[model samples]
Target: MEVAIAAAAVVAMGTGNRVLYKLALVPLREYPFFLAQFATFGYVVVYFSILYLRYQAGIVTDEMLSLPQKPFLVVGLLEAFAAAAGMAAGAVLSGASIPILSQTYLVWQLLLSAIFLKRRYRINEIAGCFLVTVGVIITVASGSGTSASFKSTGILWPLLMIISFFLQAADTVLKEIIFLDASKKLKCGSVDLFVVNSYGSAYQALFMCLLLPFLSKLWGVPFRVLPTYIKDGAACFLNMGSISGCEGAPLLPLLFVLVNMGFNISLLHLLKISSAVISSLASTFSVPLSIYAFTLPLPYIGVASSLPPGFVAGAAVLTAGLLLYSLPQARHFGNTFSQQK
Candidate 1:
């Protein structure tokens, strides 16, 4: 029940993360790289602050914090590259196509977990994943097809997106590995989620700093003017200066950052309590929900978009997939409860 609730929170927050990101990007459209950097660097401060609070409360201990930083370094590098690739690909790929392509994340998670964690899935698990992926592809591609976009942009950007997801899959699997290894180091106590989040985020911010010049160039912002661009972005984000197109200001971006933080924390917590594949599934489940959210009367977006023709069907299939995947666990828990009774 605890894991179920956590997974549900992950789905909700993940949906918010997607919606709020789109909202936040409305004002910072010209400074996409800045927004990306902001989130990456912001996580460092936020995660560390929470880590301190948890430590003070005695939920996090010295041993957990001191377990090992090497794994986090790898996680940081993987996340840095993944973000780079994702941003680059997202620049050219049509929004509709991106969601369809993102279903590859599940495939990557499955393969990486199998290889790294030596975990095998039951037949129903694989089928459930397949249904979830298919449902997302159907839901997202219903009203708009990706063929036209692919024809214009070719395959390189799409391939980069796939690679980006692959890197992300590796990062999640490695974090799971860290948690698994931490059990031994902590002698029956697991490392706190913030320990992983803080160190991983700190290292990612370090790598982001190192790659800033390259990233700015990739985003077509010259290195010398990058600081000015970021300064302007901050102004626009805060609505501090007389910046045009700062209608939403701090609220939208701040909401995005907060919800994005919640989504990440929830995701990591789910990963701690469950497997990487389960965490990924929770994240994946948000795709359709986010699609539905965008159809509502949201601010910044001038008009609410209509639902996709296949939305209901796709959602039903996705729900079934989730239930199918949980069937065995539900049964196991039920049996355990009965025995206790």
Candidate 2:
């Protein structure tokens, strides 16, 4: 019952994360890099604050904090790059298509698990992967010519978004490796999620600071003007300054950050309590819901946007793929991966 409840929370928060992100971007449309930096640096502060509180409660111990930082460093680096690519692409990609493209993360996760964990997948799992690919093709093709969302940006950004998912998958797998290695180092054979979140976020923020120049360049904001740009973004986010187009302002961005933070913590908590497969399934369940959310009459968006052409067909196929892939994992719960035969 606890796992079920947690999984449900994961789904709800994940859905909010996806939708709120797009909405938040609307107000910060001119400052995607600012949003990205805000999230990265904010995670560092929020995570460490929680870490401290957990330590005071004796939930997190010295040993967990003392574990080798190397793994967390790599996790940070991967996440930094992933954030860069994802934010760049997400700035242009439609909200609905973002979730659709994110489906590829599952495919990448499967491939990474096979290579790193020496796992063997069943025939059905392979079929599920194929279907996921087909569904993505349908979604992209359906909107390519007609929808301004895709037509304006072309296919490059969407493909880059998919590649960002690949990097995110790799970061996730590396975190798993950290957890596995911690078993050998810690007497409890497990580490608190906050410990990982805190350290990884710290490292990510560090790298983000170092990469600021390049990141600014990538976002077409000159490094010299980044401070002013961030200042304007902050003012706009707060709705305090004379910045134009700050329609949604603090409320929208605040909700997005809070929801995003909750979603990450809940998903990680779910992973700790339940199996990774279950955790992933919970998050995956949010994709369709997020797609549908855009079709609603949400604030800042003015009119309720219509569903992207072929969305129903593509979503149905994608859901089928997810279920088919999950079937084998349901039968073999608790094992990180099935042994290669």
Candidate 3:
């Protein structure tokens, strides 16, 4: 039941993210510079405020805020940059051959955790990682398009997209470490889940605001880019709602936002209740599944066109790998059950 719930939550999050991106982030392209930031920060403030209130009520703790300042800030900035770049890249690459750039941060997290966090992976974990890689490779390599397209163009925009994907992966690992470490130290209940995420988002929003001028100057782009992106995002989210027959729905975005919040909270909770490996694996499954679900209807757009026989074959291979990876872990638990019996 818990697994079911977790999978459902992740699916909801994956679906919501794509929809919200389409509705919210794509429309704010025409707004003023600071106004875009204001909208973003405003949303963050509201989201985090709910978490803050929970903490103030003794439902969580201040220790959630006791993260190492430098690393946290750096990671936050990386996350913001990755997010902006990824969205922008997706927009630019929308009509291209490869639409979905499956940023498997879970795989990166597993590797980083093993190296830095001294995480010891069982055979099952190792197998799972292999499966994930195989699946991704199959999905990417076998799907379609020329090998040249897969090759890096050395162009600024595509390079940024690739960088964004990598940075987002790093950010996921950083987040998992920070939140998990904080929860262990604080020994708080699940409420800290809300508090920690809320703080992270708030911090990221502030950091993004601070970096705006530098980013604009560095890229020789107008500060207007920020508003334009925001408007674009907003319009995308609104359109998603409309397409889903949620037109003029007052709380749809809010609901979607909360669902996203729920996803993070659930992920944090899962990390506590289970191993990071398990959490990562579960999260990884959502990525391809989301692509499959969302792209099935619009088979002509983006990565959908590539969903030919080879893509399906690759997806199958990936699924087989996931199963292979789970076998050892399952056996270990099964042995424990047998001993008890």
Candidate 4:
């Protein structure tokens, strides 16, 4: 029961991270780049802090630390790109679009796994991927209750968002390969989750810092003004002032870093105790919940959003497809997946 609750929390936080981060952009729109950077750096610090504690307790192994950091670097770069693209989409597009487009990652993951990881998926998995693709397109194309300005952003960003998720899929496949190799090589035969998280975040932070100048230029802000931008954005995110008691502009971007990191930790915990299918299903539920959250008349929001025509049905199809895709593996290898680390 506790584990179930934790998994549910993970889904809530996961969806909230996107909805809240997009909300956070209302005020800090000027500092989107820096705010994203802060989230990445904050996660690194938190993960490494816990990692340090574990090390002090003499619970970590040398093999875990030495498990070839290069693959992490590769995945980190992909992560950086995906993060940037997602943040950009959140800023310009509706909260609903982010989840709808992001769900396509599962399809990309399977394709990548087949090509690069040499994994062959069953017919049901392929069919599931096709259904997910159809569902996302249907939801986005219908654009039922999302936003008024999606026309301005056009369909380009959303399509690019799908590609960004494909990058994420590639990263996932690569990381799995790295882990499998490490397990075979190391005497202990398994890597620590914290160690993996810490290294991945560190590499991403390093790359994000490296790209700061470019990002600042794109955001139309100077690199030197990041501190001030973040400061003001934080104040606005906390609702320093309100126009009509609605959340004129809520969502602390820096604070979002905490919640986002929390979501990841919860996901990992769920994965530790259950199968990836469960984790994925929990994540799938976040889509409609996020859409629902966006439609609510929240404090910072000016107006409640409306549900799109087929939003619920489309989401259901996508989620069902994902489940069906995983059914084969779950029936045969559910135990190994739950213990995957």
Best by TM-score: 1
Q: State the weakest 10-residue window (summed lDDT) of model 3.
A: 25-34
User: What lDDT tens digits, residue by residue, belong to model 3 across residues 119-200?
Assistant: 8777755776777766655665554553556454436657667678678667666666766666566556333555545656
Model 4, 1-341: lDDT tens digits are 76579778887888888687766766566556656666777788888999989888866687688777789898789988877676566667775466667667776766676787677767776777677666665655466544545566888877778878888777766666665676788787766678878998899888888877766655666768867766765555555743232243453554566778888878766654553434555666676667768888865557887876777777777777767765644343754543211
Scored against the true structure, residue 180 in model 2 reaches a CA lDDT of: 71
Clashing pairs in 2: none
Question: Which candidate tops lDDT?
Answer: 1
Model 2, position 286, has a per-residue lDDT of 75
What does the lDDT read for residue 156 in candidate 3? 66
Which prediction has more favorable TM-score, 1 or 3? 1
Error of 4 at 127 (Å): 1.7
The runs of at least 3 residues in candidate 2 whose Cα sits more than 4 Å from the true structure, single-residue gaps closed, are: 1-4, 87-101, 132-141, 144-162, 273-281, 328-341
Residue 137's lDDT within candidate 2 is 50
Q: Please give the lDDT score at residue 162 for candidate 4.
A: 81
Error of 3 at 33 (Å): 10
How far residue 188's Cα lies from its native spot in candidate 3, in Å, is 3.9
- The count of backbone overlaps in candidate 2 is 0
What is the Å distance of residue 35 in model 2 from its true position? 1.8
User: Candidate order by TM-score, highest to lowest?
Assistant: 1, 2, 4, 3
Whole-model lDDT per candidate: 0.89, 0.80, 0.57, 0.69
Runs in model 4 lying further than 4 Å from the true structure: 1-10, 26-30, 85-100, 144-160, 234-255, 268-282, 326-341
lDDT of 2 by residue, 10-119 (tens): 98999899899989999898987788789889988999999999999999999998888888899888888888888789767876577667778877877887888576
